[model samples]
Target: MSTLAGEFKSAYSAGSGDALAAVFTPIGTQNKPYRLQSFYDFTNAASLQKDLSFALFHGKSLKVPRAEQTAWVDIFAAYWEAVGELLKYEQDWPGASLVAIFTAWKKVANALIRGYSSSAGIPAWTLPCLYTVGKYLRTFAINADIKAAPQGASSFGFQDDVAADIEKNAHLEEAARIINRMFTLCLSDRAPMEESRKWGIYQTTNLIFKTYFRINSVGLTKNLLRAINAQSADLPPLEAFPKSHIVTFEYYVGVIHFLDENYAEVREDAFFRVIGLTQLMQAEKHLATAWSMCHRGASKNRELILTYLIPCHLVTTHTLPSDQLLAPFPRLEKLFRPLSNCIRKGDLVGFDKAMSAGEEEFVKRRIYLPLERGRDIALRNLFRKVFIVGGFEEAKEGQTSLRRTRVPVVEFAAALRIGTHATGRTRIDMDEVECLLSNLIYKGLMKGYIARERGIVVLSKNNSAFPGTGV
Candidate 1:
């Protein structure tokens, strides 16, 4: 095998398409080798170096003293631009067939990432290389040909070629097979109790799970959980790392459990774990008081709004008053402040607006836009349910009725602690104005019969909707 340095020199000098294609001839008959060479010629070198430096040296794979993964990432990034350009020029090729190839590579890359995480097992700061590798790997996979089983398997217990090969062959189903086998092996020892090296191994396992989670590959996630349970020993509790990861994980798990209608388990297991992780992160004290206040409010731990949520809002603020300042965490303060405010006030309207604003800001900063976009959509949907109840204007099909009205209910009423309103000039949700006409129930509003079925508010005299019920 050629030394990495020698390969780099040869690949670098192989400037043109023919020369680049030559570099990969030794690897295989597949077009991926040529594509890799073409990629290096097209991509920027300095930026790749910078990103790789941080990922490889600072995070996971600290146990493995090699920069090969990082190099692979850099190579793949360049390869993408090159091959994509070539494909763009090749108008004669069928787009559908090429797309299938991309799909196959995507699976292969995911499997590689999971396999590496299982093998390396280290902190995030030390494994930046993995990120770069995984990024292009996933990109390649997405673009690979996703059809038949690849011809180059059984050597590595999987296919031998990179994502480019799969795309060329359109062997997605076979690529998926190889990927699944790798995934199965990677997750074979998922449970924390199965292995003695708890910290790194557990964290890496979670990382692998997160890879699946990121893709919404719930089947893989379920299989991983099963493996963990099967391998786990009936022993004491497990400790987590970075604290933030645990907090984030528990939060997602709780959401899953909640969706599954396992409310009791969510409260008992997920809630406590999240709370503990938050505390461990020193979010309760190390940060500003507002953050602590908001955190408490978000958890609904007490009726009073804790200062925790403030930090989330403060993070978003470009400027803040000296007295109400957030922490000094760059960019984060600006990002968190508005979210915290929305959570603290239980203002679904505010949350929706803030989330949109956050996404725009992230895009402007050239940050990862997709994650924020997904998050924005998620929060928007979440608050939509909490803020407004949709209903049609049920008047005669062709006739507009003046008496037509819609009913509204506060989704967060159970959590919002305040004075009740029987009837008066109350500021109801903007979207739920129709619902307000039928029922104006508040902590200290009008005293009357809530005719929920008919969507009518029977109030006393001087009340907004009903004058005879009670003011």
Candidate 2:
């Protein structure tokens, strides 16, 4: 075995493919000194150190203390080297050899990574290795001529070497299997629940998922999220992760939930730390804020726009004036300022116009659906504003100077019709206005009720009309 290894090493160094092939040739006999092994033997042996070389594209490295960290990196390096050499001989190698090579490297590398993560349950080193594996899989898919069908094709059009037409794409299936294996580790008990640790895991997993998604393997995202959520109690505080990871994970996960039509989940997870804003460009922040608008993000859409998106669009956070920071994003101001004011002032009609004017831009940015959901928030704001502005300060005879306010529902409906004319739209229906008020009351946006006989809204004065804004 040592003699053959020596001959293969010399040939590989001298670029002698024929000689290396001859070295790996199986000589089967009962009396043979030992069974001839191939790439499998090369990978498991210490000689991998000598054969290793870094690839052109790089994977991130981190300060981690896993055993044989250098050895693992070297193993990856050697795998790339073997892949490079095989490419040179690809035209000459038999078809069986090509498939065998792909199968052996993929299987061995995946098992090695899964072993480390499973054993230590630490994402520190395991996460970095996963990126390299993901990169390799991407390369493998391209080289194999694997084509990704449209996202919801139900069946991957590509197939394995098998002649059967009914089989799914072998490459996609294998990659997904490997990804899920590592993903399950993130939910394990000892898997370091710190934010930074999980951040690494999520980022690397997203990268792998991106590759898999190209081949129509996105259905697995829901499955993977279910596993992670099942273990959410075991996860750490998100603040422990660097702000950058928090932003990225939230964006990706939110989008997945959005795609899944899980609107509430998307909204709940839209809370973003302000620290990561510098890491993204203005357009990127714009897109994220647009996504947040979908569910009003607990009514923080206004705050997100004010604190992050406005600063990004107008001047960077660095140049933001203590006075009127939104000078640069004038167009954004035109679109959202009225909406914000309407939200604050209970001007539903104006809010509707502002939303209409920005619809084109929002659609162009692909945030229309999410932003549309902001209507509920606008209604909430409008209701609060109307009760405050229109409520009368009347003295009740029997009560200790009770301040009573009563306004007709028709007056409320008129305010909702304010900006519609600009868009060539007609006045909003009275029933629609009543229905919206019903929702506002139901959602605790105000302490009020419709006096159906008189067609008026009577608001309570014991506390502020808006709920949760304690004075």
Candidate 3:
């Protein structure tokens, strides 16, 4: 039985990504018969079509595995060898040729993907080619109607759109049809290749996304996302895939959620530093690398977001990554710095301004949703600072930090307006100040209860103001 990975042991051994110029390049020099070119190049359409058809027609089907994973590799190798001929298209092939290839490719590709599992290994070229195979159907079908001027018109660029919607849509339909089929094959709940399929599916899904992104179509990925999330409990952990795949998968998946403002799903819970990837973004990159990793995924190229968000004030105490890989998260740090500062000082107005200023930056990074949760950070910090302020100036062992904490709402309101000189209002809105304080205590930023009847704020003396934050 033939195995693509075994054939290119050197490349697979080299880990992910071809050290060669292009990703799709042949691993060891025994060149593949077909090479990829533009969609509009039809220098020898008739001959190319005829030759490819004959090649696929007479192509020998080698006896490979019928068992779980081996069956998939056998099927993929056979299917790719057939489509490999079609991949040599210059630009556009006859609409008939497109139809013929899609049918043949889909029939075989679908069958094998059904048996896909983590039990099998994927060939480097197999995945890249599989993606292109599907993508070309969409691209060439669109260009079929784009003909050159009879006498002579502008013989370049996207001249005109003459393809009928039916024809154009048929091509798109075929592309989606293939994607859906693969989705069912690889992502089934009891999928035979469930374990290995997890990562293989990422490569498959990445191509699907590339397909959708190409036409600038929106929302096509939502269903795909739903399907994965539906079986998320059974889905393998990040450690199951190659570190390289992890980065690419997380990059696409994380960005997908970020763009849609589906931040809560990414965090799913909470920990610290880079709230989005609580466990994923932390400092475990060193152990994960190209092909040599034990089970670790490399850092965000440097600094792994620490397990604990080392407070900006005590950054010195945290174990930092080397400078090369320890780059601070661009947008996360942008939001964290301001939110942390205002919370430390209990500056309500400053908090507002910081959020307003960083709003554009967050949106630009497509992380607005996750960063929006920074609101909780500010609330916690502001109240954290306020708790400190209400404490005695001089500390003594065995004494409660909140000994002088019985304060009136009116006084607390005055405290909020302390740094405001322009308005210089001696009185602040009682409702707003209490509302803010109420939220702080409710969220466990402080340990205390509100005395609505007396309008006095009683701070907790027995424990730290912040929950789980006591000494």
Candidate 2, residues 1-471, lDDT tens digits: the string is: 344445534554565534544443333236443434333344434555444322111233333345434444444444544453454344465443434445545754565464455443333423444555555554554344333433343322222211112235566467656766656544453633442345455655565555555544455666666766776766666666555445545544544433333223244222321222223353345446444533533333333334334323321221212325334446555655665565555454666677788876554333454444455566665555556566456566775654445767887676667634565556778898888787767655566788888999877666555555431
Instruction: For candidate 1, report its TM-score.
Output: 0.32
Q: Where does candidate 1 have its weakest 10-residue lDDT segment?
A: 154-163
* Model 1 clash tally, residue pairs: 84
Off by over 4 Å in 3: 1-43, 53-128, 132-178, 188-199, 206-240, 246-336, 364-366, 369-376, 393-402, 419-426, 468-471
Candidate 3, residues 1-471, lDDT tens digits: the string is 122323333333454333311322322234633232221132243354343233222233322223533444344344444344455343354543544555555555554444443344343234443444444444543333223113332222221111132323445555666776665545663634433334456666755664554333436777887887887776776577656555544444433433333333354333423343332232122223321332344444222222122221122122222333223454345545665566455565676677689776444333344444445555555455555566563557886443455667776565567744335566667888888887667545567778989998887665555665551
Going through the candidates in the order shown, the clash numbers are 84, 2, 15
**TM-score (all chains, Cα) for each model:** 0.32, 0.49, 0.52
lDDT of 1: 0.37
**How well does candidate 3 match the true structure in TM-score terms?**
0.52
Off by over 4 Å in 1: 1-136, 141-180, 189-208, 211-223, 234-471
**Global lDDT scores for all candidate models:** 0.37, 0.49, 0.46
**Model 3 Cα RMSD, Å?**
10.7
Tens-digit lDDT string for candidate 1 (238-354): 443445434433433332332232122134355654543344233323333323323432432211112222322222221122323435333455665665555444454555566
